[model samples]
Target: MELRVEGLACRRGEAVVLRDVGFVLAPGEALILRGPNGAGKTTMLRALAGLTPPVAGTISAPQEAMAYGAHADGLKAQLTVAENLTFWAAAFGTSGIGPAVAAFDLGALLDRRTADLSAGQKRRASLARMVLTGRPIWLLDEPTVSLDAANVARFAAAVSTHLEAGGSALIATHIDLGLAETRVLDVTQFAARAAARREADPFAEAIE
Candidate 1:
């Protein structure tokens, strides 16, 4: 499978966050998006995943084959860890959460309620849901939010497995995910130009 983006532009509300961004990802490849807090890394990932529309340009890919994992865990506080994962697996038309459970070290927390898990545990559960989808293209935003060093290694291993199985990923994060041969896309260039343009024209915001 191949995912291609050409001159992609992303926006949040009326504010354009990024522009003229483009890239191509083939099967078994991973692309890491690096940028400042407001550099629009999340917006880029959202657009790529079809969670948000691209303000400009085009992305060519099978939208149905993509899965998005946002910063939020998207878990139900009252549901057990296993229950949440099972629900996601079914929703995504996949079965058997064993792989995700083992990948994220969720065995011990499987029977526990989501609300009872620590921040790091909850993050792990959230990330595991992405794997449960069994989709080829993963769009992850800040995937390692609350994970520790060891858990981060586990997540990296999971990503490696996915790539090895002919899948691809577009991960937006500030930290290193430890994936080999992963190319980095710095979003600051596009965002900085947008910021500069806005600053140069004091009334740009008002006009928009």
Candidate 2:
């Protein structure tokens, strides 16, 4: 699978958050989107996932791509860990939840409600849902936000395995995810470009 973005730009009303960003990611390859706060890293990820429309340019992604946003959006706080997996598997038309549960080390927490799980546990459960999607491309935004060192290592291992299996990933994070042969794109450049555009017009507000 491959993902290609050409001159991708996103705007919120009159403010341009991202502009003229381009990249191509082939199967088994990964790219890390790095920048300081408000650099449009999260916006780019959302654009790749088709959750937010790009103000300009185009994104070409495989039909099977899946995106895991910064928040653990897929988890149902009312459901048990096992139930959540089961629901995700059904939604994705997968056979079962065995693999996902085992992959993320959720076996022991199967009976626990999602609300009762720790932040790391919730992140793991969210990752398990992504695995169950069986998509070849993953767009992850700050995937390791609340993980401790041990769980961070575990997340890295899971990502390594995904890449080894012919998957591709686009991650937006400040922390290292430990992916091998990963490319890095500094989104701050795009932000700077946006800033330059505003300098010519003193009345224009610079996008953060």
Candidate 3:
């Protein structure tokens, strides 16, 4: 699916963080969001993922076409890795976990409870949810957070393969993932200023 955003705006708790943000993500492409901490990169992704309703402008994408990943490593601590993948697959109306397991090298850890996994292992499992979703667009916030150098390479490779297969991704990260379909967007330019707010209806209202 193609993701199109225009004059988009987002907020974090009562403060407008980003405004006049716009970008298009076509099939097989990736956009890297960059800025200092708290610069609204995550906010942009949230709006794009439909978690945070946009404060302004428009976002056009298919319903349920985007999969979101945050720093939290969303997982069922009591469930085994395999069980977790199965649950997500079913939730997304997808029927298989083979690809995800192979993509994340989770074969050996499948039967282990998620709580017992190492941080990197849990991170991989969290990201593997993207595969289970079968969504065309991925919105990932610091996806490589707990990964080691090797796992980072693994993730980069998986993303490369995803793009090759016509998927799109929007990622916020400080380090390079070495992907060829990458484009970098700095969110600092779109920071919503108090002056702009006063001039434009106090543009954003927070979600949390």
Candidate 4:
């Protein structure tokens, strides 16, 4: 499925930071979101993921097609690794967890509770859930935190395979994963103008 956005604008806590943002992500493609700190990369991803409403503009994607991963691992501390995978797979109506487990080599930790795992191990488990999602569009925000070089490569490999299977990913990260058919969207180009800030929030006093 193709994802398209046009004249997009978003806010971070009542302050409009990005405006007029647009991009098209076709199948078998990846787009890297690049911008300095506070440039609204996370906001953009959140809006696209339907976690937050955009201040303006539109995001076009099929229903049940977007899978979003934010900075939080989205894991249940009480659940074992395998159980966590099973739960997410059930939510997406997909039963295959083997590929997800193999993608990040989580076999050794499957029986262990998430709270007992080390930070890096936890991160790998969290990211591995993406494979089980079975969603064509992945919206990830800073997905590589706490990961070492080798694990980072594992993530890159997973993304490559996803794209090869005609999927698409939109990731916001500072580290470059060096994947194929990738493009960068510098959101600073869409930095909201002064007038846009006042429009994002209604209760705030107008700026003159």
Model 4: weakest 10-residue lDDT segment is 199-208
Number of the candidate with higher lDDT, 1 or 2: 1
Put the candidates in TM-score order, highest first: 3, 4, 1, 2
What lDDT does each candidate get? 0.89, 0.81, 0.90, 0.90
The better-scoring model by TM-score among 3 and 4 is 3
Q: Compute the lDDT of residue 83 as modeled in candidate 3.
A: 95
Under the 3 Å rule for N, CA and C atoms, how many clashes does model 4 have?
Answer: 0
Comparing 2 and 3 on TM-score, the stronger one: 3
- Model 2 stretches with alpha carbons more than 4 Å out: 62-64, 192-208
Candidate 3 CA-lDDT value:
0.90
- Report the lDDT tens digits of candidate 4 across residue range 1-208: 9999998888888888888888999999999999898888999988888777888998889547988888899999999999999999998888778999999989999999999999999999999989988999999998899999999999999999999999999999899899999999988778887335546765454443
Task: Output the lDDT of residue 123, model 2.
Answer: 88
TM-scores vs. true structure, each candidate: 0.90, 0.89, 0.92, 0.91
Per-residue alpha-carbon lDDT of candidate 2 for residues 112-185, written as tens digits (9 for 90 to 100): 99999898899888888877888888888888888888878887887788899999888887887778979999
Per-residue C-alpha lDDT of model 3 across residues 73-176, encoded as one tens digit per residue = 88999999999999999999998999999999999999999999999999999989998888899999999998999999989988888899999999999999
TM-score between candidate 4 and the true structure: 0.91
Report lDDT (Cα) of residue 104, candidate 1: 95
- Of 1 and 3, which scores higher on TM-score? 3
> Evaluated with TM-score, which candidate comes out highest?
3
